[model samples]
Target: MAPTIPGFGYRRVPVADDVALNVAVAGSGSPIVLLHGFPQTHLMWRHVAADLAADHTVICPDLRGYGASDKPSETDGTAYAKRTMAADIIALAHALGHERFALAGHDRGALVAIRAALDHPEAITHLASLDVLPTLDMWDVMHGTGAAVGFHLYLMAQPPGLPEQMIHATADAFFGHFLDVWTNNPQAIPAEIRAAYLSASRAAVPSIVADYRASAGIDVEHDRADRDAGNQLRMPVTVLQQDWGAALGFDAAALWNAWAPGLRHTTVSCGHFMAEEAPADVVKAIRDLLARC
Candidate 1:
């Protein structure tokens, strides 16, 4: 069962191809769509969304397979590709009667937002990605020892049956590991929230694995094509990421600059779960990003 939090209301709405999405929308003003990352749902944005909703109409949805959204089985691995997922968001925005809107995504959702800014440039007025790099760059930067920081990336990148079987066998541990490791303040994500994420992941194991699998395959191809085509995100882009440079020996800003032309990059001291770990800082970043736009 999804957690029922106050100051937010839930609704099931149709986006692309008549697919229904479980979205938590609140506040009222200019439209802003918030997309959550992997191993979690839109609830990750609960605090941030509420803060934004005080001034803007915030639309937080469980992207297709995560949270309470429709988890249709994938026919092909490409079905969960970021490009397809980005389209679902575009359709969601259109369904909400906004032809164009600002988009902010965290982790996996950041990849989707970047894809949306690339594929549907006109539809995304501004883009903000938290704690991630583009898929291709991410793959390129991974080395022998440095790659352990994202072991799950390779594990989930495996083909169909293997990853699904392995992950499902230890679903609680798989999901709980991130909940424990990714945040500076574990208490920020209470026992119930952690359990909620674990439950969602267990139910959507196949689709979740397929989503990551696509990152190693089709998602990389799309990024390569975009790079070859000289397709930089034309909109104003803001990125708040942990300083991976000093720790991981890669310049986060330099990597983001390749894909985002009008870019403003800042490194936050917080852990991977920036939205949950540092809601005030995240909200300030969003407000500043929107102000610049």
Candidate 2:
């Protein structure tokens, strides 16, 4: 059987006609949905979700096109846009009987969470983003020699066919590379859970690439439009990140502050997989975000 968050009940929620997300839910009271990052599933939240579930209704879902969730064909650039994925998340919350809730996401999931908070401000009471910049700022900051670290972003951003074919040809190596390099505490991901993440990612290459491809195209466009319109996230926000700004040559707090007026920015000393590497810190950050909201 697949490894799962202990004590959490599972559900297959239909967020759209073509997409149904695999969700793990627990606890009660105010809801908070957690979206997983690239090369991972909702399982990444096992430690954090379990902790948050003590009081909040924790909803962790395998976002569309990853893990056990439905992967609709990426017929167009917009098909995998963060805007579209954000809609799926909103729909998932509505279907779960939540009209408004707190939201937190990591990596690619963070990008989607940012989009959701931007487009549906009324529905998100509190927001937390783990280890990523907003779409437009992400593209803007990723230039010069520093950008070399995100080679995969550019590789996957290419025209669909080659990126899909190349990644599919060596899926495990491709997915496992991130799992190995992006974690400060490798032991945080035990052998069994690591295997589960690898298997799930290996089976979802094309859709995953399409998801990244959208970031380079449609997602950026949407963010640019919002930026031009002077739109900002109208909710309490918490951003926990590695000191990527020191290496990447940007002020992480200033960037997030531009998008979120009510923001709390923190720099963690863990690797990209902070949710696993430093689950306690993540839980504290989230709990703090909830209190402020």
Candidate 3:
């Protein structure tokens, strides 16, 4: 079950030929869509969404395959490509009565937001990405022994069959590992939310794996094409990420600058789950981003 977000009501918003996402919405001002990451649902934004609800209409959605959203079995591995996921977000906002909106994403959702901002710049007025680099930069920075932190990225990047089989065999343990390792504060994500993540992850094994697999294949191609074509996120963009580039011998801000021309980049001390682990900071950064826009 998805955790209850205070002052937020749940609804399903249709956004594609056949895809509609389970979204939690609140407030009544200018729209701000918050996309959740892997191993978790829109529930992760419980606090942040509530905080923003005072001034913005917040739309939090479980990216198709997770939470109560419809999960279709994949025929081709591109089912959960960020491009497709981004379209789902765009259409969701449109259907919600917002032709354009401010967008922010954490982790995998950040990948989707990146694609959305690049693919439909006019639709995303202001953008924020928490604890992530773009797809191409993500691959470029993770190399050699230090990249072991992202072992799951490599494991899930494998051709569909085995990654699916192995993970389904121990879904809770596999998904729970992230909830365990990625956070500095255990209390931020309560026991109930953690259980919700494990349950949702276990129930959607194949689609979730397809989501990961697409990043290594089609997602990379899209990011590379954009980079080669001199595409950048043409919006007021703020990025709050752990300085993983310091350890990996790359410049995270400089890399993001290559993509976000008017970028306000900062390295936060929070864990990967910044929305939960450091929500106040996330909210402040988002407010600042939106203010400038």
- Highest lDDT: give the candidate number: 2
Q: Of the pair 2 and 3, which is ahead by lDDT?
A: 2
* TM-score winner between candidates 2 and 3: 2
Name the candidate that leads on TM-score.
2
lDDT of 3 at 150: 91
**What TM-score goes with each of the models?**
0.97, 0.99, 0.98
In candidate 3, list every pair of residues with a backbone clash: none
Local distance difference test, each candidate = 0.88, 0.93, 0.90
Q: lDDT tens string, model 3, 1-293?
A: 34689788988888876777998999989899999998889999988999999989999999988888888777876679999899999999989899999999998899999999999998999999988889988898888898999998999999868999999999999999999888888899898889988898999998888888888889999999999999988899999997567887888899999999999998889788989988899999999998995
Model 1 agreement with the true structure over 128-156: per-residue lDDT tens digits: 99999999999999887989989999998
Extract clashing residue pairs from model 2. none
Show the lowest summed lDDT stretch of 10 residues, model 1: 1-10
* Pairs with steric clashes in candidate 1: none
* lDDT, candidate 1, at 171: 91
Candidate 1: where is the Cα deviation over 4 Å? none
RMSD of each: 1.1, 0.8, 1.0
Q: Which segments of candidate 2 are over 4 A away from where they belong?
A: none
Per-candidate clashes come to 0, 0, 0
